[model samples]
Target chain A: MFQIIKNEWRFLVRSRLLIAISIAFVSILLLSIFLGNYQTQKQEQTYQKATEHLRQQWVSIDAMNPHSAAHYGTYVFKPANLLSNLDEGVNSVTGNVLRVEGHVQNEIVHSEASQMQAVSRFGKLKSALLLQYIVPLLLIFLAFNTISSEKQSGRLKLLVLQGAKPLEIILSKTLSVWLYGVLLLIFVVVVYGILNFQNLTAEILTRTGLFFLSYALYYFIISGLTVFLSARWQNATLALTSMLGIWILWTIFLPNILMSSAEKWYPLPSRNEFQSAMTEDRSKGLDGHNPSDERGIALEEKVLKEYGVDSLSQLPINFDGMRMQADEEYGNSVWDKHYGSNRNILHQQKKSFQLGGIINPFIALQNTSMGFMASDNLHHQDFLLQVENYRRVFIKMLNDKQTFGGSKTGNWGWKIDNAFFKSVPDFEHRPTQISVVLSNYIMDVSLLILWSIVVIALIFFGTKKIKIV
Target chain B: MIQTIELTKKYGDFTALDKLNLSIKEGEIFGLLGANGAGKSTAINMLLGFLNPDSGKVQINDIDATKNAKDARKIIGYIPENVNLYPYLSGVENLDYFCRLAGLKYSKTELQDFLASCGLQSEANDQKVSAYSKGMRQKVGIAIAYAKKAKVYLLDEPASGLDPLASKELSILLKKLASEGATILMASHDIFRVREVCNRIGILKSGILVKELYAKDVSANELETLYLKFMQN
Candidate 1:
């Protein structure tokens, strides 16, 4: 068994093609790591400038009736994750910027995928993608002929006559292939760690470690299956073809079919329907320009009576401001009815997307990557919610000035001090933290862990009783 | 050194070897002669424990070849008919590799000297096997058997590709190995070569050993005639 392993190593050393491919794989890993870092830095700079612009706009707002300022809203954009470059996940397909204003909760817009032509369906050609798809296939290519080629050349019979146990021979061949795969991955990882020079936190370390371990198990699964097939087949060409076919099914065909089927099973509402439904519900509420409801008119009359004012001149507060507040509060309810339904639909879409986890590990990985990057549906939701929270505080501050700043009705000429403008809080968005993002994707994590376990089990138990002849 | 008791082999509905019994003592060169698909290779494979026998057992040096294959394999060296090896390696490296597999390690000089003794030129020892001729490759196989010091040598038409000179060299090598008390079992259709190297021979016909002849008691031409008669019947 040991000699078999040694011979395999020597064989690998002598194959120039294998050596060249390994080097190319390592180079690609380095290139991806560098590109990811460069892209992340560029995004961070853009975000910093956008944040400054929003702050400047807040500081320059003109003095006005407090209630009117509520209509001038703010915006918050999703921030990128530290490791977003390693695997962008669904970040490119999802929108980032969210608008928050009085009486309306806005949807996130300007998704990267929507703004570009589709080119990479396999997703950005990253190291992880190669590790998951290409590396295992390469291993199968190398090992599928391990035994069948020997048999075709008649060395298998020679080895058998020399008294090698079938199980030991199989294991030695498998171990050789497994070691090669692991070594190639480790070489890339060591290079990644050295280039990044970043502090390896427990989370980063664990996630990276899991990535390595999972891929190694995936390689083992391929090696065991290939060896079994090679031994059973009579021809070398047939063994190679059959092993490649299995690779295609597991890595490519099945994942794509599963993704599309899962999507069809849990379809999301079209964007047009989502927008129209929200608009229709909003129109049914208080129309600030033209109030058509008799009840709304009666409520205005009752408010005048309670205030003990006639002809709107004796009122202490600004009548226009009061009217605006009533309209704004009414509109808030309308926004709730419409926007709340939109959020529900999005949640449904997420549930449907997540259903793909059971059938396709690639889907699970993609979802997990998005969740970690803070660019998935949950991160978009958090951004909108934060913007809405800021809108409330900004509007309330303006309303307090109108109701209690001793301003009379119809005082359009009155002006507040610049200090008062500065006193109003500006919009500041807090991004979803790494922990929060990871928590939302616990199901994906579970699925990945499950796959790793199943593949490892297959290598041991599924192939333990394999017959060579 | 080797024995089989009513050994048989079957693949699906096709029976390759029927119930057969045979034995070869130490220091004897046994030849298994048969036409294609007549169970000569099948019998040898059973003795090597590479394939399982359906209805019998194989014992090598008193060890059951199937259940305790490793113990039996340690005492054996196999030379395949095609003389195939890792083509990227030098002749010395190939010999070193197989010898290590057989649990023996030799220094480079020791390996080169063994190759020299096996009819390989000193200059060819360090050159890649890919650049060597078929006859040169056979000499490396012989050198591997010499270096491994195997007690039992299994040769399946091992001299098929060698030239007349190389063939003569291999016959001498086999005679020397047998003289050193090594048990040799070879399967071949080369009746003349078998007569030159083997002491006793068994002729297999339609999955049965139909005749066993002592090479010393029969002329080379007579053994060929006997093999043809058995195969025809």
Candidate 2:
């Protein structure tokens, strides 16, 4: 098998056209890595600057009402990790800067895709694009002729007569092409590591390693399937055409069609409807602005009775702050219900997309690549959850200060000093661990492995049908 | 030794090879003469274990070729009519690759010696097979057979596209291999070349062996007359 692979390698390198293609492909992959690194560095710089500026503003706030300070709120910029430079996943389309404030939950905004012109449909040339799309196509081109050419030229019979089993020939040829794909992947990854050595971490290295493994599996599938097709089909042209068509379907058509179907299956409510539903639910409870609301009145009466007082003046703390906090608690529940439903829908859509991997391993590879890189929808949702939790903590502290800082129910002019504002901790985002993230991609990873196994089995079993004559 | 018993093959309703029987002993050269579609190639294909006979058996060195094809093929070297090789690889490289496939390893000098023995010029040895003539490709095939040290050689129209001089050289090479104790089975339309090299010849007509004779007992013209009469009938 090794000898056969060596022979194949020698044959490929001896061809001027294959040599030229190797040079061109290597250059393109290097260029893509450089571009991806540049974009990632730019994002890192922007995130750092935004975070510093927000932190400074938070610490230097003037003396003001605690409630007013809660209303003023700050922003948190998502951290840009090293592997995102390679895969990017949904990072470009999903917003990175999330605004955390009092009373209302804000959506992330200002995504890179939203800022781009409509003409950028195919997206920027990133390493993931080449690895996922172009490299597999290259492998297909290399393998589509692996067996059919031998059959066409009548050399297959000679090989068989030399004591080689058909299964051995097919497997060795497929491995030769698969090794070529893996070599290209390794080249790109080594260059990426060298370029981002300063940013390397254990997690980044692990993610990059898993990324290579996933792509290696995908390439094996591509090479094995193409060689199998070449052996099965009598005509070389027919084999090449069939493999090319399958490549197009796997990479281009199936992903878009399945994504659309997933969305159709688990559609999200429009923004208007979502906001109106929240408003209607909140109105049924207490309105922080309107103390005369029925729920608010009931709460006030209950508080006064609990304190054994008949009027508001006998209360020890500001009922206004208490009411404000009550309103916030209620609002949080509302946000949870609606946002949780949306998140569930997104998860359902993702699962639906992942199920497509059984039929198209490319989809499985895409999901696994993004999931490991911490750039998929699940990662983005994790970040939002963290930010929302911080927002709740920051707002609750301010509301607590308002109720207990020697302020009356109607004293709207009550203020807290800059020292108090500085005491509230800054919002810091900790990325989800690799283990946690891997759990979310279990389906994708399983499907990819299963697809690899199935394709290999097909190649081994399918070669038995080859007609050496 | 190479033998086939009741070897039959059919493509739909057409019987490609119909219950044919043949035997070629060690150190002998046997030539199969037949018109197109007379089951000559089909018989050779069966002997190489490239096709399964519907109800027959092929034995290479007394091992069942059908039941254990890979083992049976270990001693057989085949040169097809076209002699197609890797167009991108040099003749020496092609020889080296096929030698490796046959579980044989040789130094560069030894490989070149095999090619030289087979009449392939040293100058053409390092050049790509794509630039070589059909005769050169056939010489590479012969060099591969020599390097494999195969006990049986199967040639399918080995002289079809060769010049008369190259064809004569190939015949001499086959005679040399047979003299070295290799069994040779050749299928061809060239009755003159068959008579020149073959020890015994069989004329196949409509998937049956119509006539068998020794080369020493007949001249080339006599063999051609007999073959033409058999083909016509």
Best by lDDT: 2
> lDDT of candidate 2 vs native?
0.89
For candidate 2, lDDT tens digit of each residue in B123-225? 9989989899999999999888888888999999999989999998999999999999999999999999999999999998888888999999999999999
lDDT by residue (A272-344, candidate 1, tens digit) is 8767776786566554434345544565677679887665667666655555556566666666665676677
lDDT of 2 at B30: 98
Tell me what TM-score chain B of candidate 2 gets against the true chain B: 0.97
lDDT of each: 0.72, 0.89
TM-score of structure candidate 1: 0.85
Distance from true position, residue A150, model 2, in Å? 1.1
TM-score for chain B of all predictions? 0.94, 0.97
Judge candidate 1 against the unseen true structure and give its global Cα lDDT, from 0 to 1: 0.72
Model 1: how far is A287 from its true place, Å? 5.7
TM-score of chain A of each: 0.79, 0.97
Q: By how many angstroms RMSD does model 1 differ from the true structure?
A: 4.1
